[model samples]
Each structure stands twice: as structure tokens, then as C-alpha cells.
Target: MGRVSPPVLPAACEVLVVGAGPAGSACARTLAAAGHDVLLVDQHVFPRDKVCGDGLIPDAHAALRVLGVHDEVMDRALRAAHVRCVAPRGGHVDVPGTLAVLPRRDLDDIVCRAARAAGARFAAPWRFVAPLLDGERVVGARLRGDGIEHEVRARWVVLATGAAAPPLVAAGVCERRAPSSVALRGYLHHPELAATLRELQIVWHPRLSGGYGWIFPGPGGTFNVGVGLTASHASEEGGRASMREVNLRRMLDTFAAVHAPAAGLLARGELRGDWKGAPLRCSLGGARWSRPGLLVTGEAAGSTYAFTGEGIGKALETGLLTAAALAEGGDDAAVRARHEAALAGLKPRFELYEKAAHVNRLPWLADLVVWRARRSPRILRRMSAVLEERQNPGRLLSWRGMTKLMFE
Candidate 1:
């Protein structure tokens, strides 16, 4: 076999999207489909590994549909009818929703291919070095790859760089130097275990007070298993409070030791590659959304949720929002205003997820919520609504919610 050649980069494009993950791919697809020149670049090639739970909820399905890749993704995913939320005290509740699991290695490639098919020029192994600035405004970017450097000047730039601070800082849009949370994940191949585990399993235990663990069934006989921990929590006075230090690997081991299902899965299954970890920027407050002639979307703008660590959906949504903002003919100020407004509209939901982070701090809260959910279908339905983004998670996971559950 002969070595394949690298993708060619254009000297200039109408829109330059850095980071070809869900957010960048989504934005590139939207813009390319709209008949604009879009160049999508990433540091790694397609089929690259990403550390994630690989659970796709309703919102992710909706975003996939918008990109016209819902069926394609579903075809390769392991479908689940609902998620089994296991509480600290062994109490559990099944919350119904449209869910699936497709590893990031495959899921991200499908989305990126969709963008290319939509006419977005893609180049891989090209990492963003810095912004090409013109008097405090971003005009383009400088990319380094293959021991060489290239520059692309565009009318607008979109940063979809996920969770990494250096690129955001170089672009002058970083707000938080540290990630809001972190997660470690790996795959296990056990045909018997994968065949029987029908629904996604998320466990909360005292051993994982700073986080939770999940075992999601994936394509083939593989399972995506992991643990995620929050770095901070929302204070009573509405400020950020740091959590105790946690060793994620020890946390994962503890999860398996404490949760029966996870224990069985870990014991019997053959491990795939080594465990991979990544940082998460959650709660949508990490960086400024827009500046003159530029916009930041995806995890770089804190698109991941606090409690669930679900970001694929919101990243796609925000990327499309940026595309729409730029597609509309407007001045730099006008485009910035539109993008910022759209992001602002989604802030309340993220804030609610942050409030729900209390469950991570106090695992007993999960026990109480699950106990209530097991008895009341109303509470169960509301929990389902949370997955659908129709109900505020803060409302359902609060003291008020506990009182309501008691009376009901």
C-alpha cells in the first residue's frame, strides 16, 4: 500500500473553523451547505479517539437530524430505550428517552464526513497556532503541521476548540484557565455482558461523591465505561466553590467496587486500549462567545453540562448558531450581537445544570431523588423531561422538589 497524501489548504476562505469536532463540523456543514467557502481544520485526522461516555440523548438526536446524519449515526449506534439512574443506596429509576451510544472515534468521523460532503474543505493534522489579527480583530489564523506553517485569511473565524485552554488563550477569548470537570473512559469487549445490558447505566455512590460513573453499551460487543468528576460546585451565595481533589482512576475502580453492575462488567470484560482522560468545560461560562470578526462555540465556550457532562448536542447547536449568525449579512458588531444573544438564550439551561451539580457533592440527594422517582410516575416523567430539555433540572433536584415529592 502507498502512503496517502495530506489534504490541501486554501490560502483564504470565507469562514475558517478551527477544531473539526462536533461543533466545528456542524458549523462547517451549515456554512458549506449555504454555498460559502468554509475551511475546517483539526490537529488530528478522522477516526481519532476522544474520551467520553458516548451516550447520545434526545438533544443529540435533534442536532444530528439538523445535520441530516441522524439515521446514519443511529445505524452504527447501540440503541437504548432509556437510562437507568442508579442511586447511592441501591435505589434506581428508569427514565425513558431516545438514547444511543456510538464511540467518539466513529461518531466524530461521521459528522466530519458530513461536513466535507456539504462542501467544507477539510485538512487534518493542522493545529491552530494563533489568530491572524488586524487591529484587535481576528482576520484569520496561522496553522502548523507537517513541520511547516500555513496562514489562511478569512472574513470571519470560528473557534470550536474543545476544552483546551492554550488555543483559546492564544485567540484572546479564554475566561477560565482550568477545566470545570474531568473524565476518564475506556472500552471493554465482552459479548455476553454487552448482549444483556440493554439500557445505559449511571451510578451515584458515596465512593464517587465528587462525580458519577457510567457504563453505556456501544456498537458491537463493546461497552463504554467511565467516571466523571466535577472540579467545582455552585455555592449557596451563587458563586463557584472548589471541590476536593480526586484521583479519577481510583474513582473508577471505586465505582466498580461499589456498584454491582459495574463490578460484573469490569470483572468479566476484556479491556480494549488504555483508559483515556479529557477535560470538560461545562456550564457555558468559560469564554467570551464573540469578539470583532470572530466567534467561539462548543466546549471552548463551556457547552458541556455540569451534572451529566453531555456536550455533543449543545456543541452542535452552538456551532449552527454561529453559522447562522455569520450567514446573515451584517457588520462585525451586528454578527457579534446576534451570536452573543443566541448563546445568552441558552444560559439559563446551563445554569440549571450547574445547580443540579449539587448531586455530585451530596450523593444522598440522588438516593432521595431516585427513591421519589420510583414511587411517583410524575417525578419519573419530569426526570424524562430533563433529558428532553423541557424541564429545568435545578427545579427537580432542589429542596423544593424534595418537599413536593414528599407531599405527592
Candidate 2:
């Protein structure tokens, strides 16, 4: 999170986008391409390291295509045509597609460059402090950098600044509390594992509850390994916490030691990196996305899917939708209404994913689904299509499908 920007901040812009990550970058590119004077701000410079699984699955590929950067991204990635799902009960499923793997450092830089190429001005090493308001409406943002305060006015403000949601929280747009889903990951290098690893592998053990462990292979003998789980109390029913408070460092250590996929790596693999953990804000807490001239997107808007731990694709989707809404070009309230309507169209699928996340608590259910996925190509394809956005995510929760997977 480091970059140099001009000492003097611009006085105004047509659109002020906070955060230069996927959501902000994508939004800026779309707006700039449509000929808007855009200003994108962030605390870090381009190519900064971030905690992520970094798999741009089919859905992400689709988003990049819309942004006109698909070819650029795919060209640099170590392509994997499939994501291999492995259940603790010895069943596995392979969902094939165009999946790209790269570190978030490299990926974010690629998208950010595209944003600039589209003519969006970028200001980094500048942190967002709060929203500048005109009574109840947001008209600009207050920023702090180089040990001084600066104000940049704009017609509209978008908070894509992620989990902290500082602007959103400071202005009473989002809840002023931290999200509960915490996660950690790191890279490991094992010659044997690297030589043979071809697809992303997800391990669904009963212990992870709403989350899973993943071993994603990349080029050059490196593996992106991580573990994630929500606090049980954060579940849909909101009961007492069942999973104990975890020390991510130790949990990842133990998982790598005992979990089959990483166990063998203990002796042969080198500790190529240290553990990096962060709180994952993957659920919308009834966040008021827009109020007057202010709007929120990306993780701040809860775009991440806890069930699959995917945020980049969904974040990109939200960004494009915001750009589309803004392109209609109307009053603040009108544009917001349009954006909300478009996001609402996705509620059904997201709700189903929430239910599926709750259902993941039952090991037997995961095992049955995996067992069938192993034997049934159709079941595997259905699972794959959901992430690809080619089918309804809710289909996995259907009564008929459940009955068939368990008994048929």
C-alpha cells in the first residue's frame, strides 16, 4: 500500500471514486470510457500485496471482457481449465472452465492500469478520512496524505474502499462495526505438488463449518494455500457460536500438518511465506448503499460470497453495474434507484448462497453432494455453472436436487 501522488489535490471532478482496487478501478474505467472526468483515490500504490485466493474464475473472465481488459489479464495468468473440489469423505468433483490464477498484487495493478488507460486520474498514498457533506447530501471527500488535509469536490462519491468502510461508517451509511468473517492464507512451495497441481482444489472438512481450505496451484512451483470460516454466531439463524475462536496462524499450521493436501508438503515444501489474515466482510448488513449523492460498492457493499470466498468477480460486477447506473445520467436519487434495482435482481442467488453456507455446517450433506458430484457429471457441471454465473446458485438448494443427490 504505497504510491506517490501529486502534492496538490484536484479541486473537483465529475466523479470521485474511493479505493483503487478492482471495484474502484473497474468503476473508474467504465465512467472514464463514457467520457466522465474521474478521480480514483487509494491509500496504497499499484501492485500492492493483498490477502486473496486470486482465482479469476469464469465470472471474473466475463467481467473483464465487459471492461475490455480480458485479453490483457488472461495473457499473464497461469491458466487452469478446472476447479477440483475435494471433500473430506474422499469424494471429488472437477468443474471445468477458464480459470486464471495470479497474485492480487499483479492483478490489481493490471486493472488499475486499465483504469488509467481509460483516462481516470489516480491519486494514491492518500487515505480517505470522511465525506464532505452539503446538509444531508455528499458533495466531496476529505483526504489525508503527506501529513496534510485536502478536499476534492465531485458531483458524486462512491466508497469502494473495502472492509473498513471508513467513509460509509463515518457518514452513517454503513454499520460502525467490524464484520465477523475472518480468514488467513499464505504460499507454499513443494516440487512434487507443483509439478502435478493443475487445478484449484477446495477441501471441505466438517471443522471449517461455513468455510473451506484451498490449495490453488500457480506457475513456478508455488501454491496459494488458505483457510477461512465464519464465526458460527454470524450464521443465518444467529445462534450461539459453535466453532471456537481460532488463531489463524495456528489453524493454518495445523491444517497444513494434518490436512491430506498439505501434509505431505511439511517435509518437502518450504515455508515460502508467512501467514496473512484479515476480516472478510462478505455479507451486506443492510447497508444503505446510497444517500443523496453518496454510494458504496465493492466489499464495502458486501459483494464477497462467503460460501465460495470469491469477491473480485462480484466486486467487478457491482462496479460495472454502478457505472451502468451512472451512465443513465440522472439526479443522485434516480441513479441510486437504478443501481439498487439492478443489484436486487441478484438477491435471489445471493440468498440461496447464504442458505447454502448455513447448510455447509452439516458434514454429511457436503459429503453426499461431493459423492454425487464425483459420480455425476451433470451435478458437477451444475455446481461449476453457478460460479460461472451460467445457472442459478439456488438450484443446489432445491428439494428435488437434494433428494436426488442424497438418495439417487
Candidate 3:
């Protein structure tokens, strides 16, 4: 990882982007390419690890194209992916997607560099202390780094700070709320696991309620494995049991016991300090994403995919849309309307997926549906399209084709 000293004194730029993650970098790069003076800042340094499955779906590629970083991103991604779905009966379904795998450390570094190359100034290891307000309007932000504080002034401010929207939300620049689910993930270096690099496995267990466990391979012998559960369900009477420390441990043990009993791949890999954990916040509702001179993108605005817990693609897309909207130069009311419109267009699908994830509540019925779909290629295709966000699941379910599925 590489760190840069923070700037001192008040700074001025046409745009100030807080958080240098995918969303922030994408916004900065797009605006800078338009010849706008842009500044991007993050609390962490380059090459820092972010907890993720490290898998990039086709939609993610689409987002990269919009950001104009597709070529560079393609150069860094693992070209193909093999997906395996483990059913409750221990049966596995192997599906394939035009997926790519890359570590966040490397990906974020590439994106930030690209943003800089596009003429965006960067301030890293800089803490966003608060938003500098112009009385009901955000003028800029007061940042601190390397024991020095500086005020950055900009005509427009973008919040791409991921799940924690930071001082902007906390300072009342935007309304923020907690996610519906929290995730815990870790990395490991296991040659045996690496041998399965081409195959990313998703284990659907009844124990996880609405969520599933995943194992995704990265470059070298590295792999990421994690589990997530709905916060609302996990906070109930027995909800606390689903926390990573408890349920995750049991799930991992069960997986290893059933799949790799003789070799103990997970136990051996843990001895090398190849594991870590972090939280994944679900998209929450009621976050004030835009205001006069201020706008929020990515996880900060709860734009993540509900079922798969995927945020990078949504974040990138949100960033691009936000930059385009801001380019139109609107008043507070106009910007807020545009922001809300963008979110409204996407929120329904995410909410639908979230609802579908709970189908596990009826295990036998859900399994039967999966089983039937597996046998019918047409049904599987439709289901897959729905999952990929290509079609609305609600409409798909309401279709005549699905009606036949119910009878048959």
C-alpha cells in the first residue's frame, strides 16, 4: 500500500470527492475527463484490502465501460469464471457467467491511478472531519491528515464514502440509515483452494435463512470466503447466533467436513494469517442522497444489490449517473429530483431480489422450485436473467411461462 501526505490549509477545486473507492474514483475520473478540476480523497492508502468476493459480473464490466476504465480493468481481471451452486441436499449445480476475479487492493489502486491520470488530484490517508456548510448548503469539507487540517472548497461535493456516508450524513448533509444485512469475509492462501480458482462455489444452506456462503478465488493461491445474514432476521430471538463468530464458524466447519474432510484445507490455510473479516451493509431506504451542492453515490446511498450483496457495479453506475446529473447544473430541488429518480428506477429490482431471497423460508418448496428450474433450460435462462438484473423478477414471475411452471 502507498500513502500520501494530506494537504494543509483550505483547498479549492471544481469538485471534491470523498472516499477513493470505486464509486469515488469513477466519479472523479469522469468529471476530470470533462476538464473539470476534481479532487478525490480517502481515509485509506492505495492497495488496501476491502472485504469482498472479488468477483466481477458482466454488469460490472458494463459499469467499467461507462467510467471509461474498461480497458485497464480488463487488463487486470481474470477472464473466465465457473460458478457452482450447492443445494441443501448436497447436490451442486455448476453455472457459468462471463465473470472476472480481482482483488480489491489491486482494483482500487488501478482505479485511483486512472482517476489521477485523468487529471483528478488525490488526498489519501485524509480523514473527512465534517462538511463545510454554507448554511443549509454544503460548500465543501474540512479534512484532516498527517496531523494537519485543511478546508476544501468546491462548487459541487460528492459523497462516495461507501456504507458509512461519513460526515456528510452525520452532519445532516444527507439522511443515513443502517443496512439490512451485515457480512463477514476473509482471505486465505491455499494451493488446494487455488486449484479451484476457475470454479467459484456458492453454498445455499437452510441454516443461513435468506443468505448463502461463498468461496471465490483470486490471483495466485488466494481465495475469499464469507457468509452473510439478514440483519432483521439475525437480530431476532435467535438472531445473534448467525453472527460470523458463531454461525459462520459452524457453517465453515460443516462445509469442510462435508467437502474436504480428509485434507482440512481451511484449517491449514488459517495458520498463515490469510484470513480477515469485515462487514457488508445492505442497501437501506430513506437515505437523503442529494441536496444543494451535495450528492451521494454508491453504498453511501444504499445502492447495493440486495440478494447477492454486490455493490461495486451499483456503485460505479451510480457514480457515473451522478456525475452526468451534476454536469447538467441544477438547483437543489432539481438535483434532488434527479437523484431520487435515478434511485427509484433501480430500487424496485433490488427490493424484489431481497424478497425472493427469503424464499428459503419454505425450504422444501424452494428446493422443488430450484429442482424444477434446473430441469427446464428455458426456466433456468429466465431465472438467470432475472438474477443478473436483465429482467424484472416480478414481471418474470407474473409471466405466462412462469404460470405454466406452477402447474407443471
Evaluated with lDDT, which candidate comes out highest?
Answer: 1
Ranking by lDDT: 1, 2, 3
Q: Which candidate gets the maximum TM-score versus the true structure?
A: 1
**Candidate 1 has what TM-score?**
0.96
Question: TM-score for all predictions?
Answer: 0.96, 0.92, 0.87
Error of 1 at 381 (Å): 0.8
Query: Candidate 1 on 1-408: residue-level lDDT in tens?
Result: 333345678899999999999999999999999999999999987878888888999989999999999999999999999999999889889999999999989999999999999999999888899999899999999998877789999999999989988999989998766788989998999898777888999998888987899999998989999999885432323353443466888998998899887888789888899988888999887788887878999999999999899999999899999889988968999999999999999998898898888898899989889988898888899999999999988778888876777777
lDDT of 3 by residue, 56-110 (tens): 8767888887767778877877666446666666666555566777888888888
Q: Go through the candidates in order and give the C-alpha RMSD of each one to the true structure.
A: 2.5, 2.8, 3.7
Look at candidate 3 and tell me the lDDT of residue 191. Answer: 79
Each candidate: how many clashes? 0, 1, 1
Q: State the lDDT of candidate 2 residue by residue for 134-158, as single tens digits.
A: 9988899999887878999999998
Q: Model 2 clash pairs?
A: 2-45
TM-score of 2: 0.92
Ranking the candidates on TM-score from highest down gives: 1, 2, 3
Error of 1 at 109 (Å): 0.7
Model 2, runs deviating above 4 Å: 1-6, 231-244, 398-400
